[model samples]
Target: MFRRIKITLSLLLTLSLLLIYLPQSLPIAGAAAAGQASQIDAVLVVDVSNSMNTSDTDKIGNEAMKMFIDMLSTKGDKVGIVAYTDKVQREKALLEIQSPSDKEDLKKFIDGLDRGPYTDTAVGITEAMKVLQHGADPNHEPMIVLLADGNNDFAKNSGRTQSQSDKEMAQAVQEAKDAGIPIYTIGLNADGKLNKQALEDLANETGGKSFSTNTADDLPQILSEIFASHLKLKVVPIQSMTGNGKFQEVTINVPNASVLEANISIMSSKPVETVLVDPTGTEVAVPSDNVLLSKSKSYSLIKLLTPAEGDWKLKVKGASKDKIDINLVFNYDLELAIDPIPSKTYKTGDKIDIRASLTSNGQQLPNTELYTNMNAVLVVKDLDSSKTEEIKLTNTGDSFEGSYTIADKHEYELTVRAEEKSFYRETEPVTVSAKGTTSSSGSAGVTTPKPADVEKEDAKPFPVMLTIIWGLIIATLLGAAILIMKMIQKANKGFVGQLVIEIRDENTNEKTFPQYKKLGAFKGKFNLHQLLQLAPELKETEGFIFIPGSNDRIIIRSQNGGTLEKSGRAVDISKGLELKSGDRITVPLSQADKTIFLEYLV
Candidate 1:
């Protein structure tokens, strides 16, 4: 009878668990789109302490800063500069690069940079992050480039000790990591007395690369490499030219139609003149319809936009003693995507299968030769412990694949990066949780306890009263489980997920945080006016409405006298428009001088 009671209790507990977790097990309709950036936002943080007067007397660092700015796309990439000693001496807010004039403005700022008396690496990084925090766009990728020659050397009057500076630096780095920003560091070891480990730690802790140089003259090449790597591009070497005051021709192959821009960089002590000819043997004029030319004392950059796919000829001329080095950095509109996971639930010891591929122009990369020299790796980070692990992946002709066993009972972020000798690309991060060894957290499935052995003497006849109580308990749990299953089905059909929103006051140059609005609880129309409390200026426009649609989509409608847009194209929502996950909707309030951006996510 004791054994019978134990079995009855076990059955009751099992039914209770089913009632509690049934709703959570319901399948979500679709996955959210990967958070890929449409453009880039970068900050250059330079150390200008008195020690730099010995290391970078030639100020090649300034020229490198100019070259890096010149390489940004003219289609809205933004950049800022910060020069620091014990504190921030000079700074510029992020400025969008929309034309040649914008590039010149940033270069002019770089030219005005000078040295200060003390050094404080933490101050430089902190100020750079502050600049990005105020101006960075949610749709853009953000990064920081830091150059330092020595360690922290605070003045007595600065009121900052090494320990205090270190603490602030740690907090700043954590904030950058949380925001998905990487800080690339460059250490100048001109005197062989640089703090290499400090710079390397800053980079490694935030998913970035660290570079060291013995001479400031190498700054330009390192900067170029950093710019290319940050944008997932390849800087292909063309050839080294020995000048004889005559034009020499070189053939450049635009491998495929996917190439968006081919930036040809020529580096030498003196300027090298260049002429271009198309694949059809027709001479293309310099600085013409689609070509842009930028020249400095150390280098010349010729940018070709949407060039034809074939071998093109470039002619270069320089003085007899000039030794010019040429490199081609091709920027393509490509995406690295990770295939969907089979299970929505993850747990410690679970083996996850990761597969990723490259795509361009809405098509998978077709050439298998492109994968010959490529390598891929999986990066996983534990947000709770701040620990990271990397797993190497194998190339499978057309895609990359690997497997990773979850090792901890914590939330982990997974990202895959594929690279070759000259270029690398990474997918946006995906998050998963591993709830191991059922604990009090109630995050994992229930563990059943075995019934203990019962002595024959103790196994007496069961009481009739106990039997009735046991029967009632079983009936109650079973009924609850059935109701939970029904609720799960209803919720699945009504779910529309949520929207992540941000608002900007263009006139005042003020912005709001990225916040979420829940829509899953609404069955019909969701009014945009409901969010006015978060952004009071939103009250200026007629409210927007969203209703449920078929096949995991929402229908959007605008009220009278309101303007709506998608990707800069006006949306005629009078008849209602269907939008799926990953769609961004824009509403402009001319009266209030503000704009609201909404992104749908599941």
Candidate 2:
């Protein structure tokens, strides 16, 4: 058979060189286990005072919060809305629910909320903890959802009485339980002037939960059981077994949807013996009845409601040698993106093209190996000389392209990362437009000093001993006339010479380019990247003026705190500021772009 066709063509040439030298840094276990994600920041403290305007309970609290924002899951929650009375407004800010036109414009902005007159309920839980600490997404995991129908009355219409508004609503319920943030209240007690024990102490003081409706058809099953007890979707992972007492199993599969709410948890630093086996084999403690059993000093939570979708078994039985951990959450929806949307103006050598697209519960999902499964990075910042630039983005298939350059006029601050699974940073300052160079060689320790020129040391040739140089120049001109008369009596009112910076335009004084830099000597250290390479137009800056004691011109505009020492050491002028000769500083950039300078070391 011709030697069996030369052993099948040498085994197909060793499987074509192992698929062409495979090794794109291997390990991609299903795109890194499908990029695990489960963030969550939900906030919604409605009330609309005037006592829920005589009970439609604000239209049943806007149809149970638009059916709990249409069962949220744009890859694990993100929502906001405040609407209080007796103060606190913030209508919408923490967004990220990526589509369905953002839950239909947040249910038409919660049906055009309007009813304020008085009812503080602790200023709507401190403005939903200040919109989850200023518009969520800083590692998510904050929740509020309150709905109140009265209580904490704005003390006699804003005067402070009712035991000082129930002791500041129990100190805003212990600052949302010391920021482990959980509220979930909701009580519209149909006209009986709701309050229901301050909404059950703001949902039992934090571990959330406390619902009441009284009419409007029980507000959609109590806001769908408070969003099915704070939705989660899927997390599964905690499979282990070794010594310390036997039986350890995990099988979980669950998915044939219709309100799952499965759960599992176990912890140990010492006592363990968890057993949860269901899937038609019996033995359970939370298989329904919307169960809930919590514990904390280490962990032990159980909350199954209708969990049965096949292969579910979990058992752990330990006693000593520490090791018993299992945690599985389920609510569902995670995502990822990077698409063709990178323009607001890009032209100092452009080559952008960053792609983004992949939806988890909304389902678009095929990234087709967006760069052998992820790792990109392309930050760029200038924000008037804080100058940063981190680039890596290379993948060009499912999208990511690179090419960058900026010469001047920049306020850019773009970010795009993936690794820790898709993150997107933003700061709002993307201008970019300085190609023919007016400034900005792209930072890495910026430098632009070859033109503030000053080179004049060439007129010296008279050394012919004229009578022993006229008696050593008459005793060196009498010690230079007593050090120029003590430096002109300590130059008490300006005029020494050599520190000239002057970049105007503090709102049309218009000058920023009459370039003058003679900062030759103030005696070292004016750091701060040499004052941003000597006035690359300083803006929105922080302060500094420490030649402090030796001259006493200490300025302080820290807006928060100040400390920028000098002659007694401790310098890091945060990019520069220390003037003398009638100093007249003003820095303030970004949308009013001002710099107003005057420093004169003379």
Candidate 3:
């Protein structure tokens, strides 16, 4: 019995020794076996706009590139370079650096960068996405670093406008957001002020972060920090228990955490505890007080937990100072509905019938009041005169119906604004044409035809009389056709006679034409040549002629002191003379004589 007890004690001592030593040894062994999987696939999108030529911008670019290279060197990660201005140029993969040995080549690429005339951020982002999607592993976390020194410059080119560029950039950002790709934006110089808000919006939408750098020197550190703090993990519960039950062994699988520290939180009625277990079935005690996460490597582990369940929530919060709020919900289902009918088409003066119904789980909700506001108005406009009238809507029962008068013939736009509780809904504009009637004259005149006089005595027509009546009708039709042709010819003549004149600067040769309609009048100085051009009749006179339409009528003094007098009525020639380049004319009224400067003489 003594020997047996001694043997049992020896075995127990051996087991405890194994438990303590194996736990620490197994983790090291497993870590070695898993190898280093913290490979960062990053794309650098640089803005080469002219504004980047500023001292601050250059510093930012240089620093950002340097920081990126240093981070890659430490982690042996893959990095691609995309330089963008009006267009995007991607560095060849062979030229890119994925290891420390390729740092020289990467430095060369960064140093060779030149500023472009315009900035096209959208194009840059799109190209970056293409590079990341095609070049990087889909299973890996992909990040894009976009640097810009100007507003969306892609728009100001000779071919495109600013508004168009904004739209394209917005679309590119949205696409990146949809793809679950994070974008880190660095705005340099004034570019930050111009596009900071937009960059923040993109970052918020795409689960990324944005920073502004006044100088290029700040870029490298910022980028280094960004890459050094990246993390990606896939969280899943091994077993789930609902409504008050102890969950047995909830495991979380972490895939990567190169630049981030992750904390796994298991919420239950009781505070849950976490234990790191190795493959050898030995418990590893983690430093419960504090842990330092690595910047150049990733750690993966399976978390085990046992918790009493009553609507339990498991969350993994990224541990980084600049970390954005990433809310991940599991196993969710959603239903959407619109109050009133989802769609309708109505004409002006017609009542728009709207009914409420909710579409959920393939069923229509009828009991819900779906309370909606009825103060929305539909504005109908006469397309010709642009006359518009607003019609208010009111709900009757479950349907809201309202009528508006069809004031004129037009394609009426029916817009419905409905608010159900806190949700707001708007229907797309529905186009309905207002019926229009034509008169006999066919000049866009709407008039009803009068009934024939029934009290007039009926006269019997002879065959010759009937023939004569038919001939007159044919003659009238022929005359109408001739009249139409003449009118068309006159219109063509008028159009051909109209002239456009451009006045050019004598020194700079810059030309400008006065928009008489906008200014109503012109102001400036004139010369002899301008005066002569304004009054061509002065050419007949030696050197000069009288200034027409001047309040103080001044005689045009010739070199010989001879005053040139008007030979004919100036009004006739004035009416025929079309304004052209360098013309100096004036408008004279009896009440108030106003001198007008004519930039154009035709």
For TM-score, the strongest prediction is: 1
Across 507-565, the per-residue lDDT of candidate 1 in tens digits comes to 78788888665454344454665434212345554357767777778877876644589
State the local distance difference test value for candidate 1. 0.79
lDDT of all the models against the reference?
0.79, 0.56, 0.45
Q: Which residue ranges in model 2 land beyond 4 Å of their true spot? A: 1-38, 44-122, 133-135, 138-144, 157-185, 188-191, 195-224, 228-253, 256-261, 264-274, 278-293, 296-300, 303-329, 334-602
Q: State every prediction's TM-score relative to the real structure.
A: 0.61, 0.27, 0.33
RMSD of each: 14.3, 26.1, 33.0
TM-score of 2: 0.27
Candidate 1 wrong stretches, greater than 4 Å: 1-38, 344-355, 361-422, 428-602
**How much does candidate 1 score in TM-score?**
0.61
Q: Which ten residues in a row have the lowest lDDT in candidate 1?
A: 28-37
Tens-digit lDDT track for model 2 on 523-568?
Answer: 2123222333322234334233322223534322243333333344
**Candidate 3 local distance difference test against the native:** 0.45
Q: Which lDDT tens digits does candidate 3 get at residues 1-602?
A: 99657645555554454465455545443323222234567777887767666635334465456445543423235566778777764342212343344655566667777666776777777777766654454435578877774476544336877777778878877878877778887767544454678777767778888887665544544554465445322222244333222223434332211112233322222233334433344544543322211111111121222211122233233332211211111211112222333233323454444333223232443433443332345555556666677666665534445655554546566555543322333444455555544332343544545445333323444579888996776566556546655644533331101112234444464655442211111112112333222222222322322222232122223342322113222333322233333344432222222122333322
Model 1 per-residue lDDT at 521: 36
